[model samples]
Structures are given as structure tokens and as C-alpha cells.
Target chain A: MRYAAIEQWSRQQSVLHRRDARAKIGALLAFLIAVSTTAPASRIAFAGYALLLAAAIAAARLPFPALVRRAALVLPVAAGFALVLWFSDERARAVALLEKSFLSAVATLLLVATTPMPELLRALEILHLPRLLVLVIHFLYRYLFVISGQARRMRLAASSRGRLQFRSAAGALAVLFARSWERASGIYRAMLARGFSGQFPALAPPRWRAADAAFFIAAVLASVAVRVAL
Target chain B: MPVIRVRGLRYRYPDGAQALDGVDFDLEPGECVAVLGANGSGKTTFVLHLNGLLEGEGSIEICGLGLKKQNLAQIRSKIGLVFQDSDEQLFMPTLLEDVAFGPMNLGMPREQAVARAQKALELVGMGALLHKAPYHLSSGEKRRAAIAGVLAMEPEILVLDEPTTSLDPPGQRELADLLRALPQAKLLVTHDVFFARALASRAVFFDRGRIAAEGTVEEIVARFNWTQR
Candidate 1:
């Protein structure tokens, strides 16, 4: 459901949403690279990165609290590594690890929240990412809702039939897995019926506009400036 | 002329279940035929072979083109197979994208594909929901969107497997009306007796991987006792 909400938000009209997906992807890469390579001791640069993401969130007109809450999902994994670093007496790196990871998640979320999955996948393809990897990502994103819906239905069915014991829950999960496999094959058959071969044909190749170029350039320069100064 | 023709079709699953046994079928141009069968009777399996999705020992032809690996793309474009489960058919993130998928895959330009998809969605009375996620739609809406996706491909023959499986009365009626309005030849596989009577000019009964009977819709229904008690 979170993904669905983000998908809905991506379709909403906004200045940030109007930019080309390729440009946004480029900007996201630059921001991530800048954030990752910054010196661990440079608290000022980390602050600047956080401020930059905050500005983008505002500009995109997204719900700041919700986005921040969602971005914090990355913290648990980052904190695990940070804990190890702290025990090794690298406290500065530990703190920087959490900050950089959280900022990176927010920045990545911004790109995804503004650009639809189709456009995002197309952008990845245009960037010469591996075709198999792009296709995997595409199918994974498309089917997540389906799998989740099945899980919800199973849960409801279980609840209506009385309390779902652990044994029943485990059985339901196995059924879900099998059902998903069957559905995947059916989806493939539908795709074949529509003439899908090995390659997924694009309706139109992405066209880079002057505005897209300007956005990419500005984003890269701003991120670099923040990393270098402050 | 026959829009679809098949003879001596035989298929066995990898697990050794014989799903189709010497099945012969034909679809005349501009005709609608309903296939009635019990569970595991091979109705779905037969339809899957129409667009070369499943291969078997059969001599099949669609729109005068032989069903072969080299002619698969052309055959697929001539026959649009809407699966029984709307959820499976409607896989794209948005309704419009799902509809446009077929046309896009056929190498249509983006503008043309979008236009075709819009037209198809409008035909199914789902034009307003073009941007909605497929998962957000109700069952009836999902079925309409799935049909729109196939219709966007502009196939000469439409093969629908259990088109009314989850539809309510009104939804079934609406789908019947929609199918009647379309001029494409249709092969409908369903167990709904009233629905078949409404849309199918002829009917065939499948029993154990073969066509057990074929005749007028009324005659087949009576002969097979297909209606509910």
C-alpha cells in the first residue's frame, strides 16, 4: 500500500514530476555519489545534503513527514553497520554511515516518487544498465501489488474462519507462493498473446529536452558544491 | 472463410497428463462460438494454443497463416487471448499502460499506441480510469480493462477463457453487450449457460480433452445439460 501511495503521488502534476526521468535519474546518481564520498568528519556537508533533500521534498510538494518516515526504513540496516563501526572505535564513521545512508534513501525516494516505474525503468535502460536487470526490476515492481493483494485476501479469509494459528499461517504462505508462481506463468502467457518476445518494446524512446538538460546540470552542480564547500 | 482452424491437436503436460487429445476446431469469420466444459476438461489448454502460447502436435492456422514459430508474431496479432483471470492479464502499473502494452509490443509508435489504447478503454467504458492502478479497480472494472488491453491490439479473432467467471449479473450483461457490439470473430470458453446463450451463435462441449459435441447454442446446452439445476 505504501508503494501504491507513492505510485499515486508520482502521477500527480508537479514541477519536479514534469522533468525527464533520465535527468532525474542522473541527478539522483550525482546526489548519491556526492553524499557517499563526503568526508566522515564533514558534518557541515552532511547537513547540506540533508537540507538539499528537504528542499527537493518541498519543491516536489510531497508530504515531508511521510517521506521522512519512509526514508528512515534504511536506518536499521545502516545502524547495524554503524554499531560495528562504533565498537571498532570509528565513531565518526559510524555516525556518518547512518547520516549518509538515510540521506541516500531519501534522495532515491524522491526520484521514484516523482517518476513512474515505467519511466524509471526506461531511464535505466537508456543509461545502458543490463537489460536482464532492468526487466527483473520491472516485473518485481509490477507484481509486488499482486502478491500483496493475495496475501491480504489470504489473511482476511483466515481471520473470517476464526483465529489463524501458526500452522494455518504457514500453510497459507505456502499456498500464496504456489499461487504466485501460477499467476506469473499466466502473466507470461498474456504477454505472449500480446506479442511480447524476449525484448519489451518501448512505445516511444525517451527524448531529452532543454529543461531536462538544465535540471540535470543544476542538480549535479548543486550537489558538488555542497560536497566541496560547507 | 475460417478465421481459425485446428486439426488433430494433441498435447501432454510435462507431468504426463494428456490435456488435449486430437481436438479439431474451427471459427468462421464474424462468428461467435462458446466452448463449454467441466473442470480440467481442456478448454483453457485449447485456447492457449490459439496464439502459439502453447505448442502441440497440431495443424493450426489463424487468418490463413499457419501456426508456426516463424509466423507466431503475425498469428498472435491476429488473435487476442484474454485469460480467465483479469488480474493476470492486467499487469501494467496503470490501466492505460496495460491497454497500450499490446500495441506498443506490436511496434506501434507511442502516440499511435496511446491513441489506440484510449480508444479501446473508451469502448469498454473505462476511459476515465486510464491512469488508475490495475490493482485498485474492482473485479468488474479489472475485467473491462483486461478486455480493453486485448482489444487495443486490434486482433481479427478474440479468444476469451471464462470471461464471466467473477462478474455480477449486470457486469455479465454489460460484457455481453460489449462483445456483441464488436465485429471480431470470437471464441468464448465459459461454463455460464445464460452468457453463452446470449453471445454465442454456436457452442461446443469439451469432454476429456476432446470436443464431445457441437451444435446450436440451445441444442448443445440441452444435450449436455449444462445449465444449473
Candidate 2:
């Protein structure tokens, strides 16, 4: 029953955690756009963005090291492209690419870490995301656990007999895919049986209060100000 | 009148496999029936047709309404089919939401759906775990949550596929007790003879897409030597 540590962080009590998911999402979008558009040569702008995340992290009462570590996962891929830029004599752009990617990941992590996935998805739906797309996300999140757990069990069952080999592994992978497909169909049938007619109904949608709007507006203005001033 | 009436039900897979052939069945109000069969004997397929999930050549009348394309939704709302795998049935983020999913889909107001879901969860002894994710539940809890999800719809008939698949003995006993307390007419598609004996007043044995025998649980079990030797 162990879930991702971030999922646990999301349930913790904090002011940021209490905000409407729509507001956090809006603020996240503002932060990403602002960071993406800022000049690569503006080191101070990058610092401003980083500082903003730092303050938000402290305010949310999340562990700073854990947030940074999770966000750092984006760096290895960014570093590959950054290496190409570095060798082509675009060193500042390379650094900027790395910085921007990391910052964006941090901002996204902040939003998800503060809001539960269901809340985030509801916000996405309310913001006019396609119903089909939202449903896909919904099933993907729910069944990813089911499929992966099956894979783990299959792997154990295979390896326990001391029959592990490249050929057998490939065969097991194929079986996993087949089983997953079968399970997906069964899940679909179950959904239909329960009267699913396209829309994934929200049980209790988060209320958008004046405070949420104020937080959203403040987040956007701060990001814009940093992008402009720097 | 029977809560469920089926006549001449037949279904063939696209691969030319006849899953069900010329099946006839009836489930009366407040009665419980067990469908005993081998893995490929079409027990699941036959139950699927009851909820209109699988189309086949058949006449199905659920709670006095004929099964048809236009009547599919209403027919579905009248029968709750709990799948063999609890994972398949409970897909929402939280237990409450998952339970409420059916009521909401039935076009009930959000508050009413939630209230119904809560009541259903309480009935299944899962009210305390409303906020828990399905993945976090033990298999027994997941099964209960799945039943709660179906029960929230207030279906007149309950069809459970292998309800004892992964349950321990105590869990099985607890489930049987819980199910016995519910008033819905029941159809259990299972291989567990004891479970069948515990819940069903009558039984049907399916073999290669046909009901080979129908009688009391002991009668069906003895006729086929179905009990574990």
C-alpha cells in the first residue's frame, strides 16, 4: 500500500495545501511561462524564480531537500541537451536551459505536492480540459498501480522457478501486456455496468473562494514582476 | 414474478467460440442462485448479458423491463454486477467516490449520490475508510468497497463473479454474512461449493455453454461430483 512520498506530502496540513487546486494550477502555469520566457543571460531572473520556489516551499512546510531531489530528476535529460549547447559555444544558453527546466519541474512538483491528484484532475476538468482526456488520466492513474503490481507478481512467479532468461523475460513482458489489456477491458465493462456515460463525475468539487483568487493573482503578479524586473 | 428472466440466451465470440448457447434462467425476488461452472463454461459471459454489458441473442427482462439498446441503461441500473477482480470495479480515487460513482452516473444529485454512497459504505463496513484509496485497501476491503460501489446504485439484483477468489476463511464467512443481510436477489458465479451452499437456495451447473443441471446446491453438487475429493 506504499504510495509515492509526494502523495503523502500532499495530504499534510499547510496553507498552500488548503488552496483550491485551480488556483495552484493557475499559479503553476504563470510560473512556468514566466520562467520559460526569461532571457538565458538573466542569471538574476533565474535566481528570482528559484527564490520564489524556495519561499513557496517554506510556506507550504514541505521538506526542501526532498522537493529539490525530486525536481532534480529532470536535470539528467536536460543536461544531455545542455551538453550539446555547451560544446557548440552556447554555454549560457546551456546553463539557462538546465536552470529553466529544473525550475519548471520544481514549480510543478510544488503544485502536485501541495494538492492531491484527484483535486488537480478536477481543476483540469473545470479549466475546460477535454472530458475524454480527463477520463484517460483518471484511468491511467488508477490502473497504473494495478498493472505494475501484476507485473511485479509475474516477475516473481517467473523468477521463483529459476527460469529467468532474456527469452523468458520477453515472453513474460508479452504476457503482462496481454493481461493488462484483458484487465483494461474488464475495467471498462465494470465502468459501463455502473452507468458510466462519458463523464467522470466529481463527488465534491473544491470550492473556489475569494482567497484562492487572491493567491492566484498574487502568484502571477510576482512571477511577472520577476520576469520584467530582472 | 421473477426479478430476472432470460430465454434462449446465446453468445459467440468473434473468434467463433460459443460462450453461451441457448441458456434459460430465472431469479425470483429475494432468492439467491449459484451458477457453478468450469472456467470457460460461460458463467461470466452469461452474467455479463444480464447487465447488457455483452450483447447476445437473448431475451432478458430485468425487473419487468426488456433488455434492448434503448433500455440498456435502465437495465444496467437495475442489476449490479460485481466483477471477479475487485480492482476492475473500484477505480475511483477514494472509496467514497468510487462507491458514489454509480449513483452519480444514474443522474442523482451530487449530495444525494454521496449520501447514498456513504450509506452503502456503512452497510459494507467500509464507511471508516471512505477517504482511503482503492490501492491502499486490503483485498477483503477492496471487495467490500466494490460491493458498496454497486450497492450505492440500489440495484434490484446482485451478480457476483467469484466473490471468494482471494478471501481468507474468516473474510469469506464475514462476506457471506454481509451478503445475507442484503435483500437483493443474488446470482453467484463461482467454483466454491461451500460458498454456494452458504448463500444460494438453488443452483445451476454450466458446461460448455449450457446449463447441464439445475437443482438444490446439494443436488447439483452430488450430480456432478463437484465437491473437492
Q: Each candidate's TM vs. the true structure?
A: 0.92, 0.94
Error of 2 at B46 (Å): 1.0
Which residue runs does candidate 2 get wrong by more than 4 Å? Answer: A163-167, A209-211
What range of 10 consecutive residues in model 1 chain A has the weakest lDDT sum? Answer: A197-206
- Candidate 2: tens digits of C-alpha lDDT, residues B25-137: 99999999999988899999999889888889979999999998898889888999998999889888888899999999999999999999999999999889988888888
lDDT of 1 by residue, B1-229 (tens): 7999999999999999999999999999999999998999999999988888788997998999999889999888889988899888987767888899899888888899999999999999998998787877889999999999999999999989899998999999999999999999999999888999999999999999999999988999789777888
lDDT of predicted model 1: 0.90
- Please provide, for model 2 over A4-97, each residue's C-alpha lDDT reduced to its tens digit, 9 standing for 90 to 100: 7888898898989999999999999999999999999999999999999999999999999989999999999999999999999999999999
What tens-digit string does per-residue lDDT give for candidate 1 at A1-230?
A: 34467887788788899999999999999999999999999999998888888888888999999989999999999999999999999999999999999999999999989998888888899899999999899889878887998898889888999999999989999999999898899898888889887876654567889999999999999999999887
